[model samples]
Target: MYGWIWRHLPGNAWLRALISLVLTLAVVYVLFQYVFPWAEPLLPFNDVTVNDQ
Candidate 1:
């Protein structure tokens, strides 16, 4: 999968690296800004219980 993307990216090694870095940052931003917030409430990470014994 990664190899395919690298092959499909335009230009030489330096250009490909720059584009790949930008694409990775964009994906991270989108996931944190939108996807994670939407999915967070459905997850049980906030669930907490304390028992006194």
Candidate 2:
């Protein structure tokens, strides 16, 4: 899959690398800015339960 993407990207190796970095950063930014926040309330990570003995 990654090889497919690498092949699809335009330009030489250096430009491809730069484009990959920018694409990676864009994905991270979208996840943090929209996806994670939208999904946070549906996740159980912060829902802690402490049992008393």
Name the lDDT value of residue 2 in candidate 2. Answer: 95
Q: Tens digit of lDDT per residue, candidate 1, span 1-53?
A: 99999999999999999999999999999999999999999999899998999
TM-score of each: 0.96, 0.91
- What lDDT would each prediction earn against the true structure? 0.99, 0.99
Error of 1 at 37 (Å): 0.4
Return the number of clashes found in candidate 1.
Answer: 0
How many pairs of residues in model 2 come into backbone collision?
A: 0
Q: Where is model 2 poorest over a 10-residue stretch in terms of lDDT?
A: 41-50
Model 2, range 1-53, lDDT digits (tens) per residue? 99999999999999999999999999999999999999999999999999999
